[model samples]
Target: MVTAAADPTPQTADAQPWGRVDDDGTVSVREGDDWRVVGQFPDGPPEEALAYYERKYSDLASEVTLLEVRHRRGGASAADLRSAAKAVSAKINGASAVGDLASLDARVAALTETLSAETETEAAAAREAVDEAVKVRTELVEKAEALAARDPRTVQWKQASAELSTLFNEWQSQQQNGPRLPKSTAQQLWKRFRDARATVDKHRREFYAELDEAHKEVRDRKTRLVEKAEALAPKGEEGIAAYRELLDQWKTAGRAGKKADDALWARFKAAGDALYGARSERETADAEASREKIAAKRELLEEAKAVPDERDLAKARALLTGIQRRWDEVGRIFPREAERGLDDDLRKIEQSLRTREDADWKRNDPEQKARANDMTRQLTEAIEKLEDELAAAEKSGDKASIAKASEALEARRGWLRALGG
Candidate 1:
């Protein structure tokens, strides 16, 4: 059988690594079966030509080595490595330079196979991350929905509004930095959040509007009260009790906003202060007028003080009665405390004089004297009868009857002496 001719470029003692220069000034690279002409380098020496082609082959080998290193170090993405491996494999096939080209192809193929599994794992991880992001976003949406569901009247609007703002900011931060969610899922969460915000805003606005209405009503009521209170200033002290009633109404009237309430209260309080000022001035004037009355009453009390120590009860009674009549004519004293003190002192003297008169009446009563005289006669007769019984007992020699009669006669005599008979 005829075989292919052996390479005409003989193998020398110093052989090149990948390419050899032929006599025709052409460079040939070795394949598995034969040598193929790659290019000519006419101006260069044979060794230089061989070296040039060998450098090209070294470059290809270096690229494949770098890819292998990057794959082992895991510095580049598996997809990017797969692409690079394909590019390098194409360059190695029928390449202009050579250094174990088949082995480089085998290495690239191995790298491609390894990257397949890695790409699948990376894709799965990315999907999982997106799912977690969606879950977090859904939780935020649920919180907003709950806040919107609260009754408007019961909600503390300031705190609730702040919480909603915080949640919205968190959503924005997550959207900007976190894993991107699927389009449909992101839209759904955003829609729910938007609707909840709308509901909260609507409720807040309505609540404030109603509050303003109520405040207006309170302002109207307080304004009327302020006008009435100011009108009472002309009544002076006489209007105090009536003004007190308006003040009570003012207390029950709710808030009318800070500025209006403060202004209205200033006017109302000024009216009340005016009334009190009038009352205070009147009291001071009355107190000055009462000094003379208090002096007159003191003089009367000194005169009445002698009644309690008088020797004649009848004369003391007459003098006290006259003093009391004059005291009434003195009229009432101002500052009730001074009047009470003077009246109490006079009352004590009057009570003493009356007690003495009562004792004198009891002592000289005719009816009491008559009753005493009658009792004296009855005791004198009983004494005589008991004395006779004593004598009979002594004669009869009955000592028990004698003792009993003597005791009864003594008791009767003692009663007659007590009656002043």
Candidate 2:
């Protein structure tokens, strides 16, 4: 992308008229309407002298042309081009050159003008970029400040710290790669960020410090609770009530950190398990001792089954009463589930007998029988009336009335049958 200076129209020394050698072999270069003496070349022909001086002009021209190409190619900064133009223009003035020196001066001037405009545009763009970078950094600083303002109790320290780290990294990247910021602005933003970060760190440390103290308190309390629980293992099943009270105390105990809590819980639960284990062994012994009692109760249940078979309610009641008294004498069974099941079975038999006795009482009760007979008599009267209506309706050829009467009669007969009247 590097460019050479602008090329001028090519001219050979023979056709070139910008330089000449006098009879004394003195060389002079044309400057506008007048000519200026450049050097003496007495030992050479006019052609040689002109040629030699014209070569110097060619060198100057090349330098100007190189500047033009550099500007056009955009490979050099405007400032750099401006500086190079200034140096070349100085050399162009009053030189012993034979080419178009005026044209070179004009080109250098134009190049400077172009560079000045480009310099302003570049400066404006750089300022915009710097402003944007400042804004970005300021926003990051504000975010850090926001985080610092949050209540330590409410803030999740892990996530907050991570966000701060990310912001810091972004700030670094912008400092190194993005547009430069003003020193005061950059320093101000950094101070704000540093204060915010320091606040957050201080809060985190204080919060955890308080938490550690609280954890130690809870851990010690639980440790004591566990020791008391373990001490109860020698009491066997009798220690269960004390263990339950300790378990209640454990419910209100706060966290003791994960590892310590888990270890302590294992010990505490083991103590409770020991207490329950003793109870279980005693229960098993009780169950074994009550096996005979359980068998006796089952036998009584079988004997009581005969109570329902008796035709006389009084005799059934007497038999069930005797069986129930004997059942109580047989004593309680262990593994209470077996006892509950047997009791349920006996209760069902009792319920059945009670139901049968109730039914028998209703069948034999004089008041109930009297009521039934009264109802039967009323139904009989209703049936007689309906039958009369049916016969009359049939004789009159009134099919609707006949159907109604027949329905009433059928219903009344069903009721009478139910009453055994």
TM-score of each: 0.56, 0.72
List residue ranges in candidate 1 displaced over 4 A.
1-16, 21-115, 236-240, 258-263, 266-421
TM-score of 2: 0.72
Best by TM-score: 2
lDDT of 1 at 420: 72
Judge candidate 1 at residue 280 and give its lDDT.
Answer: 93
lDDT of 1 by residue, 145-221 (tens): 99989999999998999999999999999999998888988898999999999999999999999989999999999
Q: What is the C-alpha RMSD of each candidate to the true structure, in Å?
A: 12.1, 6.1
Candidate No. with top lDDT: 2
Residue runs of model 2 more than 4 Å from their true location after superposition: 1-9, 12-115, 280-354, 393-407
421: Cα error in model 2, Å: 4.3
